[model samples]
Target: MGRRVHWAGIGPNPLRRRVDRAEAWFAMVLTVAVVACGPVLVWRSGETAYDRAAAAADWQRNRFVPVHAVLLQDTGDFIPVYGEDGKAKAAVQAEWTAPDGTRRVGPVIPPAPGTAGTTVLIWTDSAGNPGERPDSDPMGAAIGVGLLIALLLVAVHAGVLLGVRWWLDRRRMAAWQQEWKDVEPRWSGRR
Candidate 1:
């Protein structure tokens, strides 16, 4: 539990003293619950859609940079594609717009893998013309457990509020104390 902070002059505020100490214990429990379960909630071992996007993003950031490629349409601008290999290796049939307003189309040889949402692939024919790569997809694995943890944390916060409200009700607590008091009456039971 964190040390209670008091106001500069008045030790602890009067309202703070009225606040039940049990409320603090529940807050501690909620914090520890999140901290203990957080790692498991965030991570998933099996693969899913989220994992694929993460994997692709990592590969792009680490392995290569996007290339300035032209769209092969008779009248279309250019978009960027990740390069095949090192800087020296030019993209075959890789479309790019030259300084002039013309589409520079070349066969992107060897054929590259498709990306997350869309299948963007090209292969160079014998004449060095780029064509689409064969597409194949089944159920793929990914990582997306963080959402579950977020829901659990929300529930914990609700529980904390409920506990605090119960503690603040004086009558229920007073009645409970009275029952206990009658069971083990004080020495001066005249009252």
Candidate 2:
């Protein structure tokens, strides 16, 4: 038969100090709090982030329209710059006719190594002003933000636990020092 192990500072133990029991109870309560609150906080934060990201995506979809623009200059070979979409991009001067039938020319980012006179698709606002590409994955954004928040929460919980432990250790040290002050002289026959 295996022997059951008893947790320190729990149950009826004459050797258990008051600080030990307090530490044990505090740890138990903190564990319970983390278990009870962590999931709810993470879920709520993730839901809120997802809703906001989705709304912004919908708004951008409605506001931006695609237009074909012609590159006027060759996109020379250069270090590839990655965009939010993780795709390499190159900047070049381009011209396009807006929906309002007005000619517009500006710097545009297209796929790297673009040739002159090549037509590339670009996003623009309703008034034909340059605009960023709309976010396509709200769920990804939610997951990323949620994970970050969860990590922060975990860090906070760990810090609190460590801080409490440190305080308890200080109390224990002070009590030991006080007790030793009385015991040391008697034990050394200096009384």
Candidate 3:
């Protein structure tokens, strides 16, 4: 026999049994709906993150400046004591000239471990207060990574839904078999 294609209601039902047909229809509809929504969901999520990151970067760049300072003493167990390059880092009492040309003293990070006079770059805000470095790469690659994660989550959800439906279908088929076994003997005896 030739293969038959059932487009919703156009022809003979595709599956031989009613429950199988119903399950197939449900699965098809759900797959289409989730696939259709995936792009819009990912785009909105990524755009929201990018916009928030850009605003924070703008604020940091405006409020912070880099300055050179000296280490007054050894770090003595201060946190974040190593630079990104994994070299020994130390914090100490230090002095630096601020944007307004006034000398200021505060605890600052040195380029490396030093006894008293090692120079290091530190970020400071107006009024000569120590602060963190300004942000760079406003949107960066985080948006793409975020979108990928969102799409992957959508796929996983759809797969789980289908898996549950499949399990239910197996139980239904078993119940049908037991019903047939009970009725077949009675019908054959009457004939």
Most TM-score-accurate candidate: 2
Question: Clashing residue pairs, candidate 3?
Answer: none
Tens-place lDDT digits, model 3, residues 97-159 = 998899998877665566666677888998788876775554674577566867696778778
The C-alpha TM-scores of every prediction are 0.30, 0.80, 0.67
The reply for model 2, stretches above 4 Å from the true place, is 1-5, 77-90, 103-106
Q: 116-145 in candidate 2: lDDT tens per residue? A: 999988888878887777866889878988
Model 1 is weakest, by summed lDDT over 10 consecutive residues, at: 134-143
Instruction: Report how far residue 76 has shifted in candidate 1, in Å.
Output: 4.9
What TM-score does candidate 1 reach?
0.30
lDDT string for model 1 (4-52, tens) is: 3331222344554334444555556666777787655555532344666
Query: Order of candidates by TM-score, top first?
Result: 2, 3, 1
Against the hidden true structure, what lDDT does model 3 obtain? 0.72
Model 2 TM-score, 2 decimals:
0.80
Which prediction has the highest lDDT against the true structure?
Answer: 2
